[model samples]
Target: MADQHTQPAKLYRMMMPDHTCPYGLKSKDLLERQGYEVEDHPLTTRDETDAFKAKHDVETTPQTFIGGERIGGYDDLRVYFGVDKPKDQQSDTSYQPVIAIFAVALLIALGLSWFAFDSILTVQAFQWFVSISMCFLAVQKLQDIESFSTMFLNYDLLAKRWVPYGKVYPFGEAFAGIAMTAGALLWLAAPVAIVIGGIGAVSVIKAVYIDKRELKCACVGGSSNVPLGFVSLTENLMMLGMGLWMLVRLLG
Candidate 1:
């Protein structure tokens, strides 16, 4: 067999007037980075690209070929090079999405407070931050209610008892969040927040502390890879605090 270093890998990529295929560029770079010489084949026109695809019996561009073997696209190239592509895995639980939600909510609240009251650090800002976060979290759950309910039922006591509660939970959360955001209808929002938050806190505590069951949290939504533990506990506690704060303000 010929030495791999002397032989160049063939790369067919699109280089059109309006669009240059990003994956094609990436494939070229990857091959170069892996110490392989590349015979770059740039299809300059749409028709040319289409003809190349038809002739090769491939559906996409950025196709790589080495020693008469097809190596597929950018993702395939990574796999062949023994590189791991980023994906959500149970072993690699992340809280980045949850953190980002809260961070952005706080910034938005701060901006609103500055515009309305000429201040960022205020009770209203805190309230808005929490309310916005609730709505965002609810949106995540609502996106795939089926998946959220399944994960929720694993730990949520109420969801386990009343199967329908899992489905209704997102709606209730959204309603509470909207009401809280408006700073109106305390009678409706406060109770809902308190009831759900209280129940969630208790359930999380029981599952994590009492039973010591290791599971994933559906807090950021059903598809999240966040672990069921302290972060989840903190979320429930924040809701409880918001509910209590609203109640005290309304009563006082």
Candidate 2:
């Protein structure tokens, strides 16, 4: 007898840019074998796609919903249905950005140290710290990969990578912490520098979107794991002012 374990008793609507999808077929086959009502929605326009999501409360393509709870993108649901290995079971995902960020931060730290020795608490020292810290923040960006995946991948390894309702909460919290710290540090050192940092910070804050929280953050090269939240607005604004101040010097 065919293995009865692989099927999901759910409704799945597949959205695609084109009809040819090898990955989706494999997913659909798996869903069908499990007794799912798989509906293929051939998207011809952005408006039609938007209509589908609104009708179904679907935030993700290849959306797999079980009794209305979005199980997630189909592949992750497969794992949820025992189709793939548990995420933690996999090896530490290569934290490529963490490694790279650390290297870059090291350079910034060195520069900061050099400036500190030359003068007692000057703008140059503060600037070095801000530069290195921005690079250091690449750690968060690295961890934000699960967030990155949602924008491109059909299958999600972590939790729901793309949801239409709200993903900004986490990104807001994280960068806020860094920005607050950066801005406060600069505020103490140089008032002008904080203004420049503020602009970039605003750009980052504006970049916050519902898609940003698609997956759990794998911080510090996957060494740290924490859920994201929205209380970060305060700190992020602070960093925004300081970082923007320093940045303006570069442009002008």
Among all candidates shown, the one with the greatest TM-score: 1
Residues 1-252 of candidate 1: C-alpha lDDT, one tens digit per residue: 336546679999999889999999999999899888899999999999999999999999889998778989998888777685533422467889899989998999999999999999898999999999889899989999999999999999999999999998889889889999998898889988998889999999999999999999999889889999998788788788898889999999
- Clashes (backbone N, CA, C under 3 Å), per candidate, total 0, 19
**Poorest 10 consecutive residues by lDDT, candidate 1:** 84-93
lDDT of 2 by residue, 108-139 (tens): 65666576585445655554444455435534
Against the hidden reference, what TM-scores do the models get?
Answer: 0.73, 0.28
State in Å the error of residue 23, model 2: 4.2
Alpha-carbon runs more than 4 Å astray in model 2: 1-23, 35-44, 54-59, 93-252
User: What CA root-mean-square deviation does each model show from the true structure?
Assistant: 5.6, 15.8
C-alpha local distance difference test of each model: 0.89, 0.47
Model 1 lDDT on a 0 to 1 scale: 0.89
For model 2 the local lDDT of residue 111 reads 63
